[model samples]
Structures are given as structure tokens and as C-alpha cells.
Target: MTAEVQSVDIASPIDVISEPVILTYFETLNAGDFQATADLFAESGVLRPPFDEELVGREAIAQYLAAEAKGMKFQPLMATYGVLETGDTEFTITGKVQTALFGVNVAWNFVLNPDSQILSVQIKLLAGLEELLNLKPGQDKKKE
Candidate 1:
């Protein structure tokens, strides 16, 4: 009789991610502390959007925030809805944002460094973003 070894898969996706840092992100964003939110990322961090060009560096991120704040008349009342672990160092954060216009669900894909600093964040929409923002596909609110 011969003994055989079996391999098991460990790359399973987790349903909920309890990261305090992620919670802080929403808190800072809701507080209108754009600079503090940018500081949560690493020095060379990048913010990628679904339709717009990628923004890199703290300064660029700050400029983007400033432009958006000026253009948009409302801010969302956001709360973390759930999280999904996608990879060893990556996860997707899902949230519900309630605005005056409408309520929308959004997803944020985050890649973190060893030090817990965010390396990149890709923003995605699950529902109601377009109609609520009153924009078309590929249209930028920053231009308003």
C-alpha cells in the first residue's frame, strides 16, 4: 500500500473584512477632510476611476478632491455595507451612499502595502451613480 498526499485550496474569498483603516477612510471622507483621506495612502499611491484617468501622488489626489468638492452640490451619507477579500493583499469594500438626489451603492477595490498603507484604490459603482450624479457615461462631474 502506498500513501498519497492531498493538496487543499486556501485561496478562498472572505465575506466580511473588518479593517479599522478602511472605516477611517469613510469617516475622513464624510468629514470633508480630503487631505487627511489622502494621507491614508502611501506616498506613491494611485486612485483609479471607472471612467476618468488615474490620479497618482498626494498632490494630484488633493487636486482631484478639490475639483470634485467644488462641482458637486451634495455629499453622500456613507456607510460600510460589506467587504470581499479578493487576493492576499487586495480586497473590495462595498458601501451604501445616500445623497440628496438618490441612494447608490459603490465598491472600492483596495491594494495595500505591507505597512497597511493603501497602494491603489479603484472605484466602481454598483447602483444609481449615473442618475443621481446626473451625468452620462464617461462624463466628468469635475467639469461641471
Candidate 2:
């Protein structure tokens, strides 16, 4: 299966993502420090990944990322922040995730606690149904 290259307007200036913890999370993740990334979250924080079971707590998030996100890098393009109805702070970020296998657009919605720790991060893939269906296992590797 072949992946399509979509045109993204990267010429526009990226909006500032003001949360220090969010910034640190991405930095640690890109640096392959999964434990440090997980530490930025609350003790009972939740990580809801696309098409996977929700992982709750720092330990679970750390383990899951260590196994799944080894060579992944996140390039954040833009962000928006607001308050949820439940009084929690919500921050949404749009970015492209680059892996050893492929690159995909994604959105991460974060709910933060009063202490500014991440309470939950819900990840969603920004792809159409056809694009998603076209993805195949080991597609990025050459057949020996």
C-alpha cells in the first residue's frame, strides 16, 4: 500500500502552546525519555490512544509509550486552549507524528488539573476513512 502526501500549510506561523508541562512532555517524548514524559502527567492521568485501550496512570502510560513510541517524533503545528464544562482546562494540539515507518497527522486533546498536570490526553488521527484503510503493516519496509 502507498501513502498519500497531503499538502499542509506550514508557512503560517505556529501558535504558541503556552503550557510548560505540555512542552516538556513533547520534548521528553521526542528524546525517548518515556518515563520523564509520563512524569509530567498526574499520578492518575489517562492516555487515550487512537484505536487502542485507554491507559490510566503514569506507570501504564510510561509502559505503553516505551513499547510503542520508540522512534516516534511529534511536530506540533498549532494549539488551542479553553476551559471544559467540568471546570478543567482543555488544550488541543494539532501536529504530525513521524515514526520510523510513516508520518501521520494527529490531534491531541489534553485535560489538565488545577496543578497544571495532565489529567488526560486523547489522541485522534486526522485522516479520512480511505486514507486509514490504505495503511498496511510493514508498508514502510523494503522486502528482502
Candidate 3:
């Protein structure tokens, strides 16, 4: 009689996801703290879009943050857009993240890792971001 080995996969996509993951750079990113944003990545993390250049490791993220930080005017407006888990190690976040880049709003789709670190961030710079600096997606800051 021969013995065979079997493989098992008990972890579903949700197993690796850290839902309600902490993102502590919202206000800092708006404040042009690129270094701060860069610090949020894991030491070996990667940030890339579907058709964009891949940013790998901490230094790369720091460089990218430096450029973005240089273009800041004031605090950015951001919120929790949506969360989707594709696999055990893959997660997606679609949020209304705004900045003064091109004086427009930036709706970002931030693909992240299990540790709440950034893997990718795609921004849809809105047409009139300057006009809505005080708004946070569903809420209007002007009403205050």
C-alpha cells in the first residue's frame, strides 16, 4: 500500500484581510507630509496602478511622497470609500481622497495589503477640487 499526500486550503479571501484597518495618514497626507505617508508602507511593500509604474520598497514610496508633498497647498479631504477583498492577501479601497494637485479633487482607489499598508493608489483628480476643499464626500464643510 502507498501513502499519498493531500493539500488543503482553509483560508478564504477574508482570512487575510484586516477590515477596519487603521489608516493614520489621512490628515497628514493632506498636510503634505509625504514622508509620513511613505512611512505607512511596509518595508518591502509595493504601490502600483493597473497601468502605472510600480513603486517598491520604502525609499520609492518616500520619493513619491516627497513629490506629492511638494504640491500640497493645505489639508486634503478623505474618507472611507469602500472595501473589497479579492483574495487572502489582496484588498481594495475606493475612497474620496482629495488634494490640491491641479487644483482638483482626487478620488483614489487605494489597493492595500493585509497590514493596512499601501500596495497601490490610483487617483481620479476631479475637475473642481479647489471649489470643494471643505467637503468630505457626503458631508459639506461649508455648512458649518
Worst 10 residues of 2 by lDDT: 1-10
Ranking by lDDT: 2, 1, 3
TM-scores, in order shown? 0.62, 0.81, 0.49
- Residue 96 CA displacement from its true place in model 2, Å: 0.3
lDDT of 2 by residue, 1-144 (tens): 112212233433233466788888888988999999999889999999998899999999999999998989888887777776666788778888877766788999888887989999999999988987887766645778
Between prediction 2 and prediction 3, the one with superior TM-score is: 2
Q: For candidate 3, lDDT tens digit of each residue in 95-135?
A: 33334433333444455665667666655545454565554
What lDDT would each prediction earn against the true structure? 0.60, 0.82, 0.49
Q: Rank the candidates by TM-score, best first.
A: 2, 1, 3
State residue 33's C-alpha deviation in candidate 2, in Å: 0.5
- What's the lDDT of the predicted structure labeled candidate 3? 0.49
Best candidate, lDDT-wise?
2
Structural RMSD, model 2: 7.9
Clashing pairs in 3: 30-76, 105-129
